[model samples]
Target: MSVTDEILTPRGPARVDTDVPAGAPVALLVLGHGAGGGVDAPDLLALRDAAVAAGLVVVRVTQPYRVAGRRAPAPAGHLDEAWSVVLGVLRDRHTGLPLVVGGRSSGARVACRTATTVGAAGVVALAFPLHPPGRPERSRAAELGTGLPTLVVNGDRDPFGVPESGPDVRVVTRPGERHDLRGDPSGTAAVVRDWLRDRGWTPA
Candidate 1:
């Protein structure tokens, strides 16, 4: 599979860069960015590159906030609406194939929340933030519902202790890394790819 930069109009303008084996039956994995960055964040780009190399079609989309050149995070209402748009685009483009949506930090939150409502094949939560670093009690994990096979990959020392374990959830811990799975990109993608394959997802 190879990457091709393209733009998809969801809301105003959504910049989507995709990598997939042309005309091959493949699953679509949506990649989102962290709160303070766009789709081009270093960690996000690395994941995109690794997933693409593994033969999966990967789509990295910029949030409307970043597209508008604002540093502040979008309000929940606006964020949800924008995600709806992005989801629609992904669904339309990859019709009949398994769809996996995930993001960095805030991006992961948005995608996870959208999954239950959007009906994706599965959810890929990379560096899912349980809560702010020091405020573990204020976790936002409830949004990630069960029954849907979810892959939660986070650093061993990730502030929220996401590796602690959860019933019906597959979790992978990246040793000595931070919120982003920095050290082992291939290993990280391998776990996700294997899980999707187990669920009968279209091979990359």
Candidate 2:
């Protein structure tokens, strides 16, 4: 089943839509949405279901700006602050349950930026925008180039550009999908499942 709750953050009150696994859960995965999207993105929905089936609790977070019904997302710093508040709620509620933080698009960028702040076990960056649409000079690769364990599932045809593979960052490309990757997520789901399993987050 699903449940929704709100938490006050520095920016405002953000909402979290939680999907719990049927059986016991050993971990929690918190995902934020793209700049122009919500928890209803097909990839996020699929990931929620797949993760639940794999015995994880997945929470889809709506930033405070979205909660206020704004189409434009707040600045990166604001996003991080609001996300930190949401992460705190999950951490307190789940206690020892390990946490994996991630998101799609802008959300993915936020996850990478705040991974350590939230003490995430690892980070899943779905369709991470390696750079702004046509501005290849202003690359965001530095964000994903950290030593932390990171999984990047990017659309090969994404206008945002596909990041090159790195030692600690594993890059998985999705064919035929752009930044949205909303139509079908089977391949993306499999990648995430295997990544988690390889890291021992899921039973081998």
Q: Which lDDT values do the candidates have, in the order given?
A: 0.72, 0.89
Residue lDDT tens for model 2, 107-155: 9999999988888989999999998989999899998865678999988
The prediction achieving the highest lDDT against the true structure is: 2
lDDT string for model 1 (27-110, tens) is: 778877878777775566666665665556888877777777888887766666687677886788889777788887888878
Residue-pair clashes per candidate = 0, 0
- Candidate 2: misplaced stretches above 4 Å? none
TM-score of each: 0.85, 0.97
lDDT of 1: 0.72
Q: In model 1, what are the clashing residue pairs, if there are any?
A: none
RMSD of each: 2.7, 1.0
